[model samples]
Target: MLDLVAVLLALGLLMYLAYRGVTLLILAPAMALLAALLTGGLPILGAYTQIFMTNTGAFIVSFFPLFMLGAIFGKLMDDTGSAKSLAGSVSAWLGPERAIVSVVLCCAVLTYGGVSAFVVAFAIIPVAAALFRAADIPKRLMPGALALGAFTFTMSALPGSPAIQNAIPMPFLGTTAFAAPGLGIITGLVMLLLGLAWLNRRAARARAAGEGYGAHADGVPGPDVAMREHAQGEGFDIAELSGDPAPGKPHRDGNLPPVALAVLPVVVVIVTNFAFIRIVIPMLDTAWLAEPLFGATTIESVRGVWAVIVALFFAILLLIAGNWRRLADLRASLDKGADASVLPIFNTASLVGFGAVIAALPVFDLISETVLGVGGGNPLMSVAVSVSVLSAMTGSASGGMSIALDSLGPTFVDLAHATGVSLDAMHRVTAVASGALDALPHNGAVITLLTVCKITHREAYGDIFIVACAIPMLALAVLIVLTNLLGSF
Candidate 1:
């Protein structure tokens, strides 16, 4: 049908243009209107003003706090030298011989602790570059190592992760960040071990072939225009990093806070997050939540966001207090972190708007029916596939997952209840599924990682695809099978 053709064309153009570096702010709305136009009889302007803008605004309202706090938290960590201290300590303790492991572990800790992957990339690259050179490992593999750690397990499968991917499913499933801990641990371990095996084996092959951190023109550490553009599209303002003493390079250990002091904020993030989810929020008198002015939502709908915000708030305070002497201009750092959160939240919101318009199309029902019709009567499989496909289409795990849950969350909830499926298992599946196929060539995160590492897709994407994409897919499959066999833990 012409409707199907129109939707596919719009999606294809969106993906291609996004991959070519067109900002999604323009592409998302433009492509959305294009689809509306092609679908004839649709109210194009109304779609834009009502459907698109409403969803976009709603997304911003619901998620802006998390984005602002997360960006500020990551910025504070960077400005205070905590991120560098942690990365350096990991590299030093693991030593250069374990360059790949050190880089992966460093990224894992930062991202798991709630630092933006962009911040993790910038923070870890110098340490990774130095280690790769020292260990005689090929520099091209650095992106894969970074991708495996920051992009895979910690971002999605790790229970208690403060990453947006992990947070996004909570409201839809009425689950906590620590959803299905047993299953999450198993899936996270699978991604970590399988990814390490692949990366280490590749490194061994390259070593046998006598390749060592090959020379490059832009090998020096610094964010170029391309990196900034890609980073901004993903919601990280690389301009914020320009204020750093060395900008792109890592700081010396002597100047960094002790590893204990540096890592304590991260500890605070996890501990306080757990405490608020299990103790603080539940103990509050949320009975007033039923009031109409409060959107008449329940505590479960808001608990996850509240926990993350409070945790990040305290963690930010701790970072500033511990590093006051080092944070030269405190106001500037806070201002920049606030500024950085804007673009990323809006960028993702635009994608949500685009998805809103597409979902409004009469044709979207057909699409949803087809998606729901699959999974062999299993709501878990249906939710996973839907989230994964949409994530791949939008090139954003959160964006895609948001759209899927926004539109189909209720339907899936009904199906789960009908089938006696646990909401906790659904939560874990949705979060893990988002991380699977969203790392395509067009993904903002993928482009930013390649740009940051100064490597081409041809050179680094194979391994990145395996670790961030392929292995995560494998982990998702494992999660589904285990959940199906044993039910939620």
Candidate 2:
């Protein structure tokens, strides 16, 4: 009982620290270590080893490079006005009356292609700025809709969302890729329709209400940083990235040849990912390979790290030219780009580590014992519902999942061993459950987007909460029912 209290206290402390804006990477692990000390784990040595190994592992960090790869592509798209061109091309097809729907579609597709919401936001916002401007829509309204487009279904309920926050739970749950694919696809399509419908209606309502209809229309959209509300700090020099503050000058009816600008980074990242999988992964399959390095890592982990480094290199080139103007201007631009990504990365990393500590220690184990005692007959439902409720309370998908997964992941593995369920299914349930609950008003990602986009928590969040919570909760119930019904077959 005391162990359970210690664990919950640790989780609560970490969550509170995150809320207070402490460095998550630093604080979360600290909370975990503190918890371990209270619980009397394998040893202080074991806890330290676990924290370092998990937090700093190459596989753990491969996503950082992936992010760099994605961010560079987004940054280029933002700067070159290419994203607007893409948005423009799509809007041209979808028609003005349906422009908002089109933007949502674009966001959904790009995000489903494995982009994070932050990357999607940076990439989409500028283009949305252009598309909305052309359609006479307000920029403030665009962020909410755009965030929904990228996040709502494709991220929360859909298949193959590359969100590590979502994907990491799969192995823990005992589900298969094939198990939930059909349901996930249907959910995405249904969600896409619902989102578009809601957004279109909102656009119409705003238009009819005539509140700030034409107010603060002071910007041109596209990669024109000179035209943006530049954030303070040493970030990128907008002048170099923006290439002259003049939104005019008819620079030409054309920019970089579309092929080079449009596809370079994407192609580069794909090649790197494939190359590492095929060429590098097999090379590490030997006994001697372990000793050649510092013995701290296997070639596999190093390969992952190297791949990220290469991706970032290509990314820097994709964003900046080799000329004097770009160099003189890069310091500020690079700094700014780094700034956009740094805090979020650090925050995510810290939270993940803290989550690891909580899990690796007995805190999670203590919770599981308690839940199992109370779960009674329908353990699966109990697990899902309890996780969902806790996540919603905290307004964090990953954080809540971390707490739940750490506690129950091993137990679920044991259950799968006994019941013949797949870990992948369990992972899916945990992930879906986390994102669903995270629809709460205070979830950092939701709150951040709302704050940055200048929307009230009141205006849009309630609708989002309904979508996040209702759809997935019901979906999970239906899945369980069908699973049982079909198991008879």
Please, what is the TM-score per model? 0.96, 0.68
Q: After superposition, how far is residue 305 of candidate 2 from its true place, in Å?
A: 12
Candidate 1 residue-wise lDDT, 1-489, digit = tens? 889999999999999998877888999999999999999737988999999999999999988999999999998888788999999999999999999999999999999899999889878887899999899899889999999999999989988998989998887888889999999999999999999999999999999999888776433345665566655543444444343344432333356889999899999999999999998986799988899999898999889888999999999999989888888777877887888888888889998999889888999999899899888789999999999999999899999999899889999999999999999999999999999999998898888888777798999999999998899999999999999899999
| Candidate 2 TM-score, true structure as reference | 0.68
Task: Give me the runs in candidate 2 sitting further than 4 Å from their true place.
Answer: 1-13, 33-82, 129-141, 170-179, 201-214, 217-346, 360-363, 370-396, 399-403, 468-489
What is the Å distance of residue 117 in model 2 from its true position? 1.9
Single out the weakest 10-residue window by summed lDDT for candidate 2. Answer: 225-234
Measured by C-alpha RMSD in angstroms, how accurate is candidate 2?
Answer: 6.7
Weakest 10 consecutive residues of candidate 1 by summed lDDT? 244-253
